[model samples]
Target chain A: MKLSTITKTILTTASLLCVNQFSAAALIPTHDSLVTVPVVSHQVERTSVHFSQPIAASQQLSSAIDSYTGISDEYWIEVSGKQLNQGIDLDVNHPQALIRLSAKQTKGAWLPDDHAIDPQDLSLFKNQRSIANAFSQKVTREQLATASIFPNSSAVKIAKKAGVGKFKLKVSKTLKSNQRYLINVKEKGSAYQQVLFSERQSYLAGQTITVRAAINYRERPLKNTKHMAFIKSPTGISQAIDYQTEQGKIRLAIPNDLPATKPGQLYELHISSQGRDGSSSIKRNGKVAFAVAQPTARMTGNVTANNQSAQIGLEVASEGRYEVSGIVFGYNKNKVLMPIMLSASAHYLQAGIQQVTLNFDPEILKSSSLIGPYQLRSLKLTDQSRMAVLHRNHVKQSNAITQLNK
Target chain B: MKKIVLSIMLCSVLLATPAMATQGLAFIHGTGNQTDAYSDYWTGSFVNSVRQGLNDPNKYTVINCDFDQFMWDSQAAGCLANQLTSFITNQNITELVLLTHSNGGNIVRWVLSNPTYDSRYPNIISKVSKVIAIAPSSLGTPLADAVNQGSVFETSLGWLLGYGSDAVSQQQVSWMNYYNQNWLHGTSGRPSLPVIFKTIVGSDVESAFWDGDSYCAGYQYQVALETTQNWLDSCSDGFLNCSSQTGAGTQWFIDKQRTRDSEPLSHQQSRRDCFNLDLIIKNDI
Candidate 1:
């Protein structure tokens, strides 16, 4: 990262590019690249010391990543910081198991100041001046406060929980297929009424069906929150729903069983609630459409290198959805490698498409090939297009032998 | 003398049967599922774990509200309320513990905030006690941004709600926006929620993270930060970035009993039906 060397190299490259393709390297250096690098370096140094004095603030863990483990269940969290200002995420290129810290210094010797703040180190965010006083440095304390949070956030509180809080049920699932639909409501032990809580249920529209509604609360001031329940059908005597204050949700399955949306029907499903005289509904689109459960295709296999070639295949069995992918698990020359590149969406695999020619640096596969045939991962329907993984250990397998098929 | 007497009485109640001594719970499921989604959530793993948490065989029940855009409107809410009312009446239920995951949290809030339907199910709220919300999207999810921008999911939700015509349907966006802004802020019109714990999930490892439809670990905190930036002033579960969900005593309780987030109902899980059994179980840890 030497500025003078970089400048000279860039100038040489640009000059060379000018002769090779004028359209490609169309710009001329405004100043000596060598001199400009140092000047820019000096500017960076000047801007860095904005907050030389460490401020006091507890680093709170984000809600999305496990604070204790830091490593995500599927992906590890790699934090990087320059000087004192850590990037918001920088999740993409960072390696797993790495914790990054950042901050800028107004001097070239800023490297020594760059390090993770030790939890035991108190007053890390202390002694910081008001942003108004630090205006020149642009290290406004207010901005820092805005950028960082204390340890008292909700995300941290949950991290402190000795037990993960869970929702309780009063009864069991009784929605029988091809039979009567039975829904029940109830509350667990009677101990925390002062702490208000309730339950609800709902149904989709445009379809005819019976539904029962209810609102269960913990008495007193919590009366505003509305808890409910309901069901949908094509058409018939709609089931009556109940909502009672100072009570718990109670339910019973309807005597008639209903069918799902058929081909001829242009209907979708929905369920929601109105809290304290207010209700919101979820539709079969956007942010939640994936929950609708679209027809999907699955393929499973592992990476193997018998000869000098590795072949992959995918199997399909979907109905109206698009896209599918398969990851061939294997080893190359020994370094861990995962080339995520497989996409099959929009059409079902009635005709199993199997066969993939993996063009890769044979070196990386030597170590991975021993891993065995990988049971392909499933792509969360959030994007029926992106081959990106949605969840792990989710790919459905085909009993019939399949090569990498789309 | 009066002060002494009151102190003694309070102490007796505390020593005899404090709320902490008696574990109360309620379970509600998110969207999706056909035959028995709520109860059978995660193929019954979730419900089973919740049932064990209540530590009562009969204490658990299922309210198959069938929300999750999985049920017919009007009817889903009404039936859910009925089931809740009957159960409270039948079980001498009082001082209950309440908990919900994802959309279930929204359903529970609606019931607590509305009373017009209360006549049918009397004193249903009176029996409740503690409240815990897990990854509840009290506010519209950041993923909704895409939906609002006219992604297939947003269009579907809009169409399903019957947007312009139905007040309830049209309320989706309004409610989410209002809820996100006020639940954390608690404006004059919208009072703050009265739950003991606003639990959230924190696990970056998810099925569809970038896709917005993934099980967002930050689902709760993101809404809090976007709306009342100062709401959760502390840390978050795992998925919600810590900065967004941090604030106040949204106290966290570490759960170590379960092997993994994907485990079957090792923690009290509930099954949906006429009775949601998850409402009865208690957590081992």
Candidate 2:
């Protein structure tokens, strides 16, 4: 799904950083909403390339970093000019290109660019001029990555000599002006574990269940990812399960005595793996949900029908669709009678009351006199889910003999 | 007036004699647990057929034992036990005969062998002179065993009268194996059963189904019966095989040589031989 243009504008403004010379309001809109930070330079020939579509600065930076190193969602700096001048400057009065980070971008945990590189060893370049940390304290290379104007001087660096990189610029810092710069960011992807049930049918709680997961690498070491499973019962309680992995699948039997499940209750299975890779850590999680099968079904209700009005209030303890069927008969003693079929209506029965209104054709009773006896024979209830009849009730001649005032 | 009083006194004195025993016949119909309160025992003609065949409506009083609950569990047995005791006491019955069919035979066995009732309802137990079980699943049915092993066909007759398959599955051969020797007799050895038990096994597969049968018919019953026969390793009466209908102790085999098609007793038509034997044989005993 594409983000609406209005949403993109709102997100862009929320994360864009302001430079010292430009007011917060002035830093918002530039050429197509790209923050233009002024670079320190003197009479440099500047050129601007216009693309048909306004490309997201983050996307461009991510591709550049990935092409150089497999690493993505890392900050990089890209300067259009060829020279790496040591002290080149830009006019501070002019509105120049500023570095911006997309609000939606996900940057991985803050860490030094290199495992060995310390905060003191970092360098910042504005138009190729290395600058000091605005705060007297040595800012970590990772800390100097973003542009913020509050402290007057913020870290700006060409960490990898890439033209597009992230920088934190202070509002107090002066630029020579008329110099173009670009600051771009790439959003990091989180490690994930996708869990799925091995079987397609609804399982009883005590039934043994097998699940499989696709583990994706993030910060966790490939060898040491500890797989674990947890079940959250219907009662908002969770406990770890002792699971065994065989042939790339996780299997465990749901405890037989799991607390009784309430109506519409669901048991959620959480499969996750955790590992620590020296200084980096990763926690991957996945989830699947199912309901527990009930052992017995209890039904309580009455099936009442007459020529004028008929209704059934059946409450089945089991869950699923059920069908009702019966036969209607009128007799005057030993005389043979043809059985009349009762019009049955079907509905899904849950754990509670299910009221159904039945309509019997008045024409079936038209032949008999109004003051005669009738019998509701073989009134049966069947569970369609299990494909079996659960209950049978017949109002025989003795009790069912009543006047059919049709 | 004096002559009428003298006639009434003489009639009362004759009715009170112990020689003219008031025998009660209880028909325990089975298999259709999903049946309603009034007609829990199959069709009305089932009892009528038995009555018509007995040809002794005046000699023997018949009562249909109806357990309204739909599940065939111990609860049904408990209900039957209570009804039996009540019927014996209320009807002033001196001798009672039990006629059980299908899983109803299990209910009778449970009541008789469950020792817990031996002391409580000694009268009802003592009053039972004989039990005539028709296609009784006393040793459990192989068809039930097949259902427990997961042979499910919706078009089959067992699926309709089975009541969610729970009742049928409970009567599986293995469960019945455990139930008969362990639960029934295994408690503290078999209780002293005073009643004489004779099981009538049916081996009529051809007449097992009828075209207009309300339960099931056609290729469905044929396929179900065929598959079930393979499980029993013997001939069947459409539902249970002959070996299962008769308990494991007695080996009653249908004669293969002199048998005619007319003698095969399917589960539904097991009552056809009612006239051949003396049902009220207690008078002779």
Candidate 3:
């Protein structure tokens, strides 16, 4: 078709703009830019009896310790009630109460003559009426020692099976001079609440990190709960993030514009939930830490393996030290993948394609009965200087190794 | 002639055997950017007492680094790794025992846990025999959260506390919990650390004004700790909760379990020679 000079000029400019847009789009790096070699099996053997069962990737991967689980089920109550002549009044609200008492000598006062108070000299009162058998069990000096000071700091657990109510603790005997006491009460048997991060342990920049909160009451998800979430940077800056309820779980996503973190520094996602179940108030706080890194480098998907070692190629965007680590897996007589050993190495490199070597020890191979045609599993490439994980692959089959000279 | 042959054989045998380990100690200070940790953070008395267990007292070094930054910051863990690597190389130390207090434990744990973070980390981990963490804020403390919350709590106590550093923020209970579950090791379900990390937990703070024991460490610090303990659990050393001190590594002993006279070690006293704490560490090394 014929066109005028002005129309041709406009068409030319539009075509150039389209080309520029395509170029820019291609330059932006994403997770797909990472070079990953899928697992490839060269030989297979079948056995009637399975010696080892396949392990799930979740179990095989390293995970964080869940030591603080059930922490949400406990809450601390401040001892700010009425002060009595000997002790103070406790307003317990949970089924179980752990009361701890410690004596702190005030300023300009000398140590008390008696360091400890006898438990037998303690009394419990409800509505000004003494409960004769309030004490669940007899507490000894050794149990008190576990709290702070032996014979000085004492703790007792009161089992109030009757449910939440107010109670008071009083000392029958008067304390000596300069021994002012402080009390702490912790209530247990609250709602069950926990927050967990996704299975992915590390994330690159421009990626979203997910956190899910499970708040349960009476074996069911708590309703009408208000959830708040925030991301605390390594530098202590807190930024609130938005969350949503998805599939009956409170899910929060980390923002895309997360600032780069220093080596060994982690960003924390703190989630707090508050709700009520039938006149009882419940609150829980949970947090999960994760590492975020700039995509400084990635594997090139080129691996050269020899009998003694395997060298992996990498394409770097920044000048820094890089580390490559992976577990070497060998096939047994039944063609089952068994982990042989883990090897890692690091080196400084310029912004270009580079190589790293993973040396396999001969003695380790001999003892494990490992041969060539091995697979590198859980292969990871980390930018040590930038402190970012750039690439990770589930499995990468090496170029073949049949035997070693040694 | 037979005696002469035996003597030569014995000399050869002795020469073939490797030399004994040259032991060294490094005293790592807690949060601030210390320039002279020997005199400022850990007094000469405490350092000297602990080093006496070594064959050569000169083999010890007091690390001075900007620990107020995050554990992985260049001035924090990086500075620590540099000084530790230098110590191991200069002294030809075959074995190293690190004595860290408070947040210092987290910094060292970073180097041990993420060995690939720096080129010097693997080397430092190899030469280290053990770490003795005293009153370590391993799981962190609620006091940090209270300070960072920065309202009435900060206005009333933040100035006196003066610990609003990055390290303190990182030690907020939830932040430390994140690190424990994700990055750090030696907790309940995490993988065991390559080096044995033994913790000495300070269970309580005693700052009676008239008592002589209260003045062993800085009385003002103990007083501040006593006030700050309101944000912590009952089992606290006026600074860190007992759970935090025993959060990461294996619990070596609590304050009353090992300290002389069964005296409870306050947060400040844990770094000093109060109640024979220095002697207890000395005997341990």
Q: Output the number of the DockQ-best candidate.
A: 3
Top lDDT hit: 3
Per-model TM values vs. the true structure:
0.30, 0.35, 0.64
Q: Which of 1 and 2 is ahead in lDDT?
A: 2
Single out the weakest 10-residue window by summed lDDT for candidate 2 chain A.
A60-69
Question: Where's the lowest-lDDT run of ten residues in candidate 3 chain B?
Answer: B150-159
Better of 2 and 3 by lDDT: 3
Tell me candidate 2's interface RMSD. Answer: 41.1
* DockQ list for all candidates: 0.01, 0.00, 0.07
CA deviation > 4 Å runs, candidate 2: A1-406, B1-18, B34-46, B52-75, B115-120, B150-158, B186-192, B207-227, B248-262, B271-285
Candidate 1 off by > 4 Å:
A1-406, B1-24, B69-73, B120-122, B151-175, B180-190, B195-197, B206-281
Candidate 1, residue B5: Cα displacement in angstroms equals 31
Per-model clash counts, in order, read: 276, 37, 1
Ranked by lDDT from best down, the candidates are: 3, 2, 1
Taking the tens digit of each residue's C-alpha lDDT, what string does model 3 give over A1-406? 1111111111121222234333311112343444332221221111111011122222233322222332344332223112423456565556656565544433345445564556676787777787776766444443433222122345566756534555768777666544455454545444454444444446655555555565677468777776666777765567777767665354555577666554556777666666666765665555566666667777665565555565676777766677776665666677666566556666766676787675555455656654444555555666656555665543322221211221
lDDT of candidate 3 at residue A255, scale 0 to 100: 78
